[model samples]
Target: MLHETSRRRLLTGGLATLAGLPFGGVGRASTLFDPVPPLIPIRALPDRIFRTTVCLRPFRAAGPRIESERVGRKLVVHNYGHGGSGWSLSWGSAEVAVRLAMQAGDRDIAVIGAGALGLTAALTAQRAGARVTIYTKDQFPNVRSAWATGTWSPDSRVAMANAVDAGFADRWEAMTRRSFATFQSYLGAPGDPVEWTDRYTVSDLPPEQARGFYRAQEVTGFLHMGDRIADISPRSQLLPPGSHPFPTPTVMRNSGMSFNIAMLARQLTADFLMAGGRIEPVTFFSPTELTRLKQKTIINCTGYGARALWADESIVPVRGQIAWLIPQAGVTYGLNYKSVSVLARRDGIVVQDMGPNDGFGFNDTNETVDIGAAFASVALLAELYERPVPAVSPRTDP
Candidate 1:
């Protein structure tokens, strides 16, 4: 419980303070002597918005369930409940899930769901010499994972601080590192499936004052283990006044990897199929239904669908919505201003309202797209670029 106003400030300031700190990827650093490139302002007009999508991030207080359980005669390895970090922690989480599934000593493995976690788990199983088959109701772009923010946010709302045990941090760090390393391999892949880009965090308040808002959020009980693996990604650096193009007095910049979901999904699905893996259109209503599958080992990666399919009441739904604008050339970076965030992906420009606090949409399972909210988020970005850019002054040695 943070008040609405405080929560809004927390969302804005917290992102500027710790946005890309935990990402592990390749990026060039900016120096004082280097010339600052002019940023291509985002065209955030309502006419540019082509689609709106809503997704419920499966959030579990304790963190993702990565243990195995007996489902009748079959062994089901649970790998769901990653909250907002599903795409961010996929590879690493899959490593743990696949490891557990392999313990069953089964040559064939069945992966449930076809989202980020499921695809990664399927690929991980294939790499482990297991003949994998994915059983999912929908795949790729049709699934909820495709609606994600598509940024490298490894620890974003992964768990609640008070709800996790002491050992959770170590496991999270391991997963983050593994996921980061896996992303590097796709850096130069076709379609630019994974690549690093700059993110500018703009704030109207002064830097120190804005960070105070972030300090307030720290006591709100959200698990922030990004510091544990801070070495993995580049740190957010304060932009020198007049050296950056923004209407705001405070501007912080960081670089991290992003996934172009449209391209990445195509690549992942193709990789899975090319590796002799099979993906069947199958849906299960209960754990007992899994016993009918031929594979004795299974990795359950149903994501938000697990809340009903598995009857796990612990899984809370964090409602998130995104408004996609037509992609613009030369607009490859990201921006966070107010409570709104914009990411220019290969497929489209993603605009999102991150809400006032971590609990902004907690326990809210409504997946209906909010047209007004989507337009409002884009309007904020429109207002940002409308402001006059301050004149740059010559720098002098102190």
Candidate 2:
């Protein structure tokens, strides 16, 4: 794992370098009220970013299901299949699965998977007055949710075939709003976890392509919030339409909620345990092994593993790999170019391009994808997710 101190120093050095470098005489690293260069159209969408999009299929659990052994009859509730949005859709999805499990008429719930989805499921059950037990092969730290850029989820563009539906869009929007508010409740120093800030999303296209899901103004309310000024995200004039500094045509900019996923997960899990939630770290390869599960209700929060556990073949793998930067202090916002490349994140910068097509996997040396693809994704996401990017160069006095 990369050390925090070293990452900070690296980011500081990079910031200093940018501060001194000439960007029309201004700092090029400004996120708010700074000029955003037009996105230099880098060959089609996936061309310039994340050089490679490895299928996370390897990590995708397979079998009578991925990891299942039947020691006994353990009624299980499987919950998974949240590709990149695992952290973002965790709570909303968790609520859905938990609700189902609770209906099983059992006070004891067993949750599989330790990522954001799993952690949130455990906490929700405990809150609802249920005795929750979390069983997993790996702990929180080793889970992928801890590695996310920690952005607002529902990663709308991801692959969701058999299990999900078109109406999922509505559920996704609702979940985003609910989750954001829930996350806001735990923001503080001890949590060092969640915070709100302005995220300038720079784009080089018209509002349609730039705004993404919000491209339709009608859904903005349902998706964001009713409050045009605050509650929901709206496109404002952070910069003149044509004044965008980058090579793109237009820019979308907005401030958003962010978090240190790893820290947040740790804190949430700790709270869950304190609230009387149970944890069984022992891995059960067979469904029968779980038979000892005295709990009448079992909530399955296993991502990918759901394929075999329930014999749900609809669930497929969309691989994703994240490139973590050293860490730049005072940087809380995020940026993305299309959904392919990204740089703005709570912990640090990350470039990812793993979806249904590219094949799910990981490759560390794909830096070429980082510079271009991730950069483009940041530009696109900034304009759509947050506010519009400023046209004025950061170096400029104005």
Candidate 3:
């Protein structure tokens, strides 16, 4: 695990470790803004085989007792590991975790990591009338959640799935619905320039063959093999065009809309501040560190941070890199085929086609610029979308 930052800050309870700074340069990120902007097209490798991989279980940690931790002599809630669905399940998981956090019955609460999960956990706590504080390394825009292709698909990620009780899935389903409702709140402001692009996912056979794909296809896509995806949804609209210019046989809304992750992270930060949530912006180590916390209860929302401070092996990084194309800004919809391609709002036609071998490895060392590879992929999508999308990867997870 990349020790976010070797520098540790002294806190009242335990010490906090600052997240490792971005790879741009030492301490200062010189190439911070290299990926965003008046994005223009780039040349990628020709017929290059690109392997875009994400951890099949990105958030599942082999623990040093993270699921069971001590905090100020109170019960701590374990609410991480939604993988790509962290944002999608933010509210639901937080609701359950916060319920546990609240059961501790403390007036003050502590939240770990400030990514979408952390922010939502903090907000949920605050709403419950508990004063919440976030201890984090790299604030919002820097956390992994901010880099997510912000949609609503819980596919290709872990969420206590194959986890404990059957109730967990029901709980997740309810939360998913709740999250969709909550996402509506962050609509226009923070830059939801991207929205749910409802298009048909055509398969040669019938819908049953491709049933599960659209179900978990895009974590952000509010799919409704039975609903609608529109600009303005009466109830998170799900629109299905009878037949487009394509040959797509299977179809559903990828989700309601798309989001500029960086911007949404910023928006979430603002929401947290507005809700009166306190942020110490510090790091922590050792369970003994709780003795110094101003709050009695703590919520550990750290995503990958679990590996270091808690020494959790489950939170390993499924190294992923995006070949960002110049934003076809005019293009607001998104398309995803497993981990192959995603044309998002901020990051244009970005693809991280990691396969089983080198693609899925946790070596964040695959930042190759396969501009032509990306170009060819995008062109294919253009052709696909102009008509009907072909049968997608039949795999359950992306």
Candidate 4:
């Protein structure tokens, strides 16, 4: 992983490794960021064609809801509408939801939906000695969580900075730190469901212009309010001129974590079942149906599905599409340029464009694949890496 240095004091823990620094000196990072390392160009060849998938992210203006409310003798703990940070904050949010459910003094818990949040919350409640049963409409390859970008972006479009509650920042920090530590345990596995890689934010503009790439909501939009908890993810360091591999005048480099969602789902499912948790393939169209469940305490983690299930008008859909290119065994890193992002996962290389200011895919629930947008994303990568003419290749993973 790319190690970097920038001194700033804050709460200390096992976060030194996240910054690519030594554990003993948690406050200081290595001088790695100061020196330019050997750069490798990502081989975005044209023949690297694979399948594509798109889904809408659940966004809420007031951040994710983790409070418990009564629903006809059933205590419901809401844990949906995480926006684009669903995968990033799944475990942390699950921890909060499960803790609330535990307060109900109920040994039995029913978790709705089987996506990232649902699975994590189910596993967490089961670990707490609760008889957990997950009710979901879909699972595995069919679940929307599998369509995620699988990056460690805890605050991506989570909520408007001014719209959140006063204690939201502190709660978010606690969740981020807990989630980061939990993800670390999944590393070093053979399937590599969770791992770290160097990611670069490259831009054609000058450093000053590229840094100020947004308007009023630019900083929060670009970083997803991550600045409030920047220490959780690897700190980004500006790359010196001409030192980076990409054809960009400026680059921001950092070490970040990603999940191979399919593998992660498999692992979590197995763990849950092993821990005596149950899963039922059931669907609910309305919140009133939650009362039918045998369990007295329920946790809602339906993601975008919550909009219709709970009539939550506040939950907005931010549509996002990804073009999965054939796996390039040689390319191990990821990069973002001109709003187009490219990441190499175990299944395939994912490429998506969030627009110039990281705001293009907001409030767009269109499920249809825009051929123009898909091709434009591919074209951006082609401009940076050289390759031969395109060739047809079958799907690498089912």
Candidate 5:
């Protein structure tokens, strides 16, 4: 029997071998020599937690507002309210907003809000040969986008199934694919701004028993459009009883890209400035205030701030919080055990409680960090490592 430390080293070696292959290449039989999969423990303790942050995701029942409207002499293109998908869909949504702004035949484009949407829009406009200027009150690190979960969740809380039109899925697919392709360009760059990592879902219950978890969490019935772009994402593989090292009875694994927001933000800011794009520290009290800008075309990427800035009551706030643990070397995977989700990124290890259901944070506008709640999530994660490893069945294969 392999000791805990030996198991981790073997797993790390297996992971290193699998890392160079494509996303789903872990399925290769050569990597399955061990009867039981290796385990890499997360040092999830209260003392290791460095910080906690809270952010409000702007959710619209009808989906993100990507339309053009006349605001005095300016053609304002609205591109906010992407909910939890802002980071995942920013590039594609930027493509749409820039297309609309360019239709106004303006050479100088102004982007409001320097969050994920704003930076991407400014960069995309620059790519379109426009002189872009970002007008915002705060820059990266201080912006709400900096507090995002930093995962590839394109359709997460993006829209309501009943509220959107029939054509919305097609548009969503285009945005997801475009954003996915653009993220691919950032791979292999310094600091690993964007890269793929394997994620494990650990559960005590079997697959059939856990199928109803989604139904229990749906409060507003948000649309699940992952199926539309299924071709791009790798399929989840169920780890056999003896093939995974977890206290839980069931484990499923999948590979997806995660963003190291701090690194990605720096890269994006440098890209925008190098391309001759400018950022001005400015704030707008209302839509009519946009007329004061010298650029005739403006893209509004205000996110949840739009609820007050535009008096848009339709934009609901979905609250989320992250508890950051000091980065642990060689811990590069993600985990979902119980309600807590943990991702090991270059910046920090992110631990979050997804709430009781999909509606756990729906319509919540609170931005205060709950230290107790954050610690509770860390406690839950610690439970996985504290419990004794379960016995595995013998391998039946030759």
Candidate 6:
């Protein structure tokens, strides 16, 4: 097994050297991002599972609504429906939402929801010299954002291509670039909340076949909009079997950002508190409730809750589930294989199946654990690494 020191070498010196060669059928090195280290193979499954949780990505076809509305004396700014990009686009979205809320000329702000978007909004507003308070049904640790895969996936199921606004690309690109810049500020900080990792896309087929495989999912109209802002993030490139490290026959690799969800939420919440922001365990059943708050300006970062609370029928829930195993500290990278993704995080190793199609999770609000899918994803990874699929360990009553 390669050590951490070797992994670093592969990512920096080794990969960079390979970039100068015409490897992976690419005629030139300029086509690839700086060489990235491959994920260390998982040798064994954990004796105990850590957790399984589901999150309904608040999806909207027209993209996130950042408009302001008048509710009695309160000026409410809607900042929900980010779909799976909630964490990835939090800072940029929050910046836009708060900027709009600031136009109300209110010295105080109320941000609903305790997820990534909410915390970021509260902190952003507070930094602008506004007294901010977060009102949510659950605290940071209990929010649905905790269940996300935590990758910098700005375009993941964000919208149907035809449904977005005419100028959506420009707006979306601005938010993505800004968010990418802001996220960098948190890198190398405490808790490894924000960090870079090599995310490999492994397959047995050739590059063309793999592209065809992914194209099958794109037929659903959920386009991969990563290219719009690809300049800000690393780009993926093919790595032929001979040069790849995974036991798989072929692989593609890229270095991208990831958030340790728990660590990120904890640190953001702490930063908000230390900056004189207050959070109340409060839930609003309807839009009218915003009038009850003394704060005249409200920024709603409620995610999927907007579907009912704000009567936003356009906001759809794309439910996603993840099965987590005990943390493999030695495994510091991630992989996308067989329509399933596995990421090594500070909290745990996350295994999730994206299903046969990209839209498989569309409108699926069911929170129940799909043990079959979870286990199957693990089995797929086990096969890729040429390791035995571990037997199921008995579960204990909670």
TM-scores of all predicted structures: 0.91, 0.62, 0.64, 0.84, 0.90, 0.87
Candidate 4: segments with Cα more than 4 A from true spot: 1-47, 214-224, 387-398
Candidate 3 residue-wise lDDT at 386: 55
**After superposition, which runs of candidate 3 have C-alpha atoms over 4 Å from their true positions?**
1-57, 61-68, 71-75, 159-163, 188-190, 200-255, 336-339, 346-349, 354-398
Write one digit per residue (lDDT tens) for candidate 6, span 1-398: 11111112223433445656755434244345454444467643534356777888898988888889999988899898888788888999898999999985788899999898899999889888899989999986788888888787887777778888788888888888889999999999998999997767666665556555555554467645654764565545555433455655446666768899989899998999999888899879988878899888999988888898988999988988887877875788877777677778888888887767666788887989877677777777777778432343343334
| Winner by TM-score between candidate 3 and candidate 2 | 3
lDDT (tens digit, per residue) of candidate 2 on 1-398? 11111111222322334444445422322443555443332222333232322223212122111122323465555666655456656676667667767764677777777777788989988887788788887776666565555655344223323334456556656666666667768777574677665444444554344443223212111122122223453223334444443444543344445667666877888898899876777776656656666665666666655556556665555445564543445544444333344444444555554332222232222212334544554454344434433464334355
The TM-score of predicted model 5 comes to 0.90
Error of 3 at 188 (Å): 4.4
Which residue pairs does candidate 1 place in steric collision?
23-233
> Regarding lDDT, does 1 or 6 come out ahead?
1
Error of 5 at 53 (Å): 0.5
Clashes of each: 1, 75, 56, 0, 2, 0
Residue 31 displacement in candidate 5 (angstroms): 8.5
Model 1: CA > 4 A from native: 1-33, 217-219, 392-398
C-alpha-based local distance difference test score of model 4: 0.74
Better of 1 and 4 by lDDT: 1
Error of 1 at 107 (Å): 0.8
Put down candidate 3 lDDT per residue, 59-88, tens digits, no spaces: 452211224456556556677666556776
**lDDT for model 1:** 0.82
Error of 1 at 157 (Å): 0.9
- Cα distance off (Å), candidate 2, residue 292: 3.1
Candidate 1 residue lDDT tens string, 1-398: 11222233334534455455554211222342354577898898999999999889999999999999999999999999999889889999999999999985887999999999999999999999999999999987899999988888777778888899899999999999999999899998989999998777778988777676545544377777666775775656666677778988777666767999999999999999999999899879989999999989999999999999999999989888899999999999878787787889999999988776556788887888889999999999999999998776665434
10 residues in a row with least lDDT, candidate 3: 1-10
Q: Ten-residue segment with the worst summed lDDT in candidate 4?
A: 2-11
Per-residue C-alpha lDDT of model 4 across residues 200-238, encoded as one tens digit per residue: 766677655554453322435322445566556555665
- What are the clashing pairs of model 6? none
